[model samples]
Target: MKEFNNKELEIVKYIKEYLPFREKHIISTRELSIEIAEKYNIDTEKTSIAALCHDLGKRYKDDEMRKIIFDNDNIEYPKHITGALLHARVSSIIAEKEFNITDKEILNAIESHTVGHANMSMLEKIIYAADYLEPTRKLETAERIREKIFIDFDKAFLEVVLESITFVLSKNQYLSDKTIELYNSLVVN
Candidate 1:
């Protein structure tokens, strides 16, 4: 792993971050975070910070996530899958406003961790895919999904989108346009 800048070092308190990410995934955070840094040849510190805070917004209740998105963006969220879809953006805003986290790399990774984007940075892709495929995930095809994180990220994203589609279809829920676009785009990719 690469060395950390002082600013980067300050961002991750090390001990606190180690458990939240590790505990949730059932993979020791230090081990998993280091694996990402080593596999991607990135600074472990930055990876540590990004992995640590990737799900900060998920800590907000579904209602709170909606409230944050609603108040910050002037867009009222209807009841649906939007809270999870929108949390990435809302969390990035909080990272900046509340946490004093302004590193665009970190913020973007946090914001785009849900609903994979068209042109993701390596860090963004890593965080997004890691959060989804983390070992603790127990979705039907989770192991299959984990296999595609690097081998074919597009497929992994397609699976994520497709799962969301199936879920909405099952419940007769309204689908977000972004979800529709993503689903169609992945179908062609």
Candidate 2:
């Protein structure tokens, strides 16, 4: 078991109690997030906290997630947002309201992990790449992106965003406008 601070321990306990099924994925994400953060000289504490809470709302049903989104006045979600994309925003809210996270970067990372936006900070990139390229993902592209991260951070971020768009297109799902903006920002200008 990795050593965690009091707050992290509380978050771990919460996840174990409420979302035991997602524990493995969350740990994988946290470990990878720490690795990436260290490589880039980013704040590991914020990275770990964001990683641990990134999927905090994953287990919520769509209806429950919608209700939560509707209830939060600060959240401005697109009307078409649904499924997994909804979790990211909800998780950010939970992190703020439940865990008292005041860091804007951490909250942004959690919210943008699922569908990235333009001009993301290093912390956001670390969380986003770690979430997708964590070992448990079992995607060949993810492994390639994981390796690319150490060599060329910006390229890896771009690749991951493109890959995410490709995956969503493959699934015929509704792609978030944030993702498209990220791709354009990286490739266009």
The candidate that achieves the highest lDDT relative to the unseen native structure: 2
lDDT of 1 by residue, 1-189 (tens): 345456445434432453344345523333454565566576666666676666556556778878887788787866766666766776677667756877888888787666655556767666765675566666666567766654665667567557656877798877666556656655664
In order of appearance, the predictions have TM-scores of 0.66, 0.94
Per-residue lDDT of 1-189 in model 2, one digit per residue for the tens? 447999999999989988899999999999998988988899999999999999999879877888898899546556677858889988998999999998999999999999888898999989998998999979999998899898899999888888888889999989877888888889987
lDDT score at residue 40, model 2, on the 0-100 scale: 89
lDDT score for residue 158 of model 1: 68
Would you list the C-alpha lDDT of every candidate in the order shown?
Answer: 0.63, 0.90
User: What range of 10 consecutive residues in model 2 has the weakest lDDT sum?
Assistant: 74-83
Error of 1 at 34 (Å): 5.8
